[model samples]
Target: MLRIATCQMTSGPDIGANVQIAESLIRKAAREGANLALLPEMFTIMSNDPKDVLRLAEQYQDGPVQRIMSGLAKSLGIWIAAGTMPLKTDDPHRVTNTMLVYDAFGQEAARYDKIHLFSYEGQQERYDESELYVGGHKTVSFNLPLENGLDIRIGLAVCYDLRFPQLFRRQSGIDCFLLPAAFTTNTGKAHWEVLLRARAIENLSYVVSAAQAGRSSCGRAFWGHSCAV
Candidate 1:
């Protein structure tokens, strides 16, 4: 069986501290013989203020976070999926929630910008990702070449994309799907497991998800049940 690890995190507003925590977890996963490692959504920063994301957003090719992940992947000889990092886009009001994939050699292999924007409102809760992020234009997938001559195609997706099964339908050739979500406690209790199982059952593919759990620095709570289905 293929080995993989999905991290459950509680990220804060501090980017440096978050990265340190992520690196530690990644190392642990690699040491455990995980061929592929997945991180949670907003793994680097989870600030209440959207503007903070823009400030932290970095260009795709050159960024401290990207460099670090690439280096780690190469050193460990594993595939690292740096799950949603804020990326610089043309719109100052918005950032791209991009997932960067690095090969065993520390080379950039693929990238996926989160396509679905999240918008929800309750009597006491509300959030609109479109206000601070623009949707991605294309679907993203990559191949994981294994030693046994078995190459697996993995599809890429983020939090809200789970709500739209059609988006996953378009990724016909993928052998697995990676989802990184920061789902709230309220919603996670209501729909998280059902949705994940549905995606896997419908697509006939494996689903690896990492999520943020517990109360965050922003006072928002997440329901974390990171798992593979």
Candidate 2:
């Protein structure tokens, strides 16, 4: 069996500080013999202001976030599924929330921009990610070669994508799904694990999740229950 690790950490508006924390956690996981390290969504920043995301957004391949994670994966000798970071686009008003996967040698293996943008309006909380993010239109999956000379197919999904099962259904023979989330406390408490379980059951595959577990810069609580199966 392959060893998978899900990192649970807090994020703030400061990307540098968040990267430090993320690196430290990934190093610990490596020391503990984890073959793969999955980071939580918005692992770098949790800003209340949309402008913060716009300001922090980096270009697809040349950004600091991608460079650092690529080096980390090579140096640490572990596959890293970097949860989600802001990538610049043609639209100045919006960015793409993207996941970049790096292999053990640090090469960029695959990229998946999140297709589902979450827009929630509740009594206490209101969010419209569509204003800040443009949705991705494609499904992405890749093959991971194990140490045993065998390879497993892995599918990708981000935070709000979990709610739609049809997305997962489109991909065939995915051995496991790499999901990174920053679910709100209320929704996560009620639906997180159950939904995860249901997805696994429906696909007859494994689901690995890494999540943010604390409050955002605006004091909105996140439901963090990182797990793998």
Candidate 3:
């Protein structure tokens, strides 16, 4: 069996600090003999202002975050399923919530933009991800070659996409699912674990998830509990 790790974090407005924490966790995972490491959604920054996200968004290849992940994956000799990051889009006003995977050699292996934008309105919380992110239209998956000479088909997905089963269904022969999320406290308490378990059972594949935990600098609470099933 392939050993995998899911890293949870409570990201704040400080991008540098968040990156440091992510790097540390990834190193720990590698030390523990994990073949692949997964990070939580928006592990780079979580802010109360949409403008901050826009300001920090980077192009796919030019971003410092990409460089960090690539270096770590290469150094650790492991695959890294980086969590969602804000990517610059053609529309200056909007960004894409993109998940990027780096191979053992630190090369970009695959990319998947979040397909479903999260919009929630409740008595205690309100969020509209569509305001800042552009939804992606295609499904992405890749084959990961293991040391045992086995190739595992892995599917990529982000927070909101987990809510849509059809998205997972499109990835026909995936052996595992990597989902990175920053789920709100209210909705996560109601649906997070149940949905993850259901997906695993339905797809007959292993599911791994990394998530934001506790409270963020923006004062939003998340349900952390990163796990594999």
What is the TM-score of each predicted model, taking all chains together? 0.98, 0.98, 0.98
- Each candidate's clash count: 0, 0, 0
Give the candidates in order of lDDT, highest first.
Answer: 3, 2, 1
Q: Report the C-alpha lDDT of model 1 over 1-229, residue by residue, as the tens digit.
A: 5788898899989999999999999999999999888999989999998878989999879899999999999999988889889999888778899899898999998999999998889988899998998899899898888899989999999988999999999989889999999999999999999999999999999999999999999888999999999
Name model 2 segments beyond 4 Å from true: none
TM-score of 2: 0.98
lDDT of 3 by residue, 1-229 (tens): 6888899999999999999999999999999999899999999989989999999999988989999999999999989999989999999999999999999999999999999999999887888988999999999999998778999999988987888998898789999999999998888899999999989999999889999999887899999888888
Q: Lowest summed-lDDT stretch of 10 residues in model 2?
A: 212-221
lDDT of each: 0.92, 0.92, 0.92
Task: Output the worst ten-in-a-row residue range by lDDT, candidate 1.
Answer: 1-10
Q: Residue 69 CA error for candidate 3 (Å)?
A: 0.6
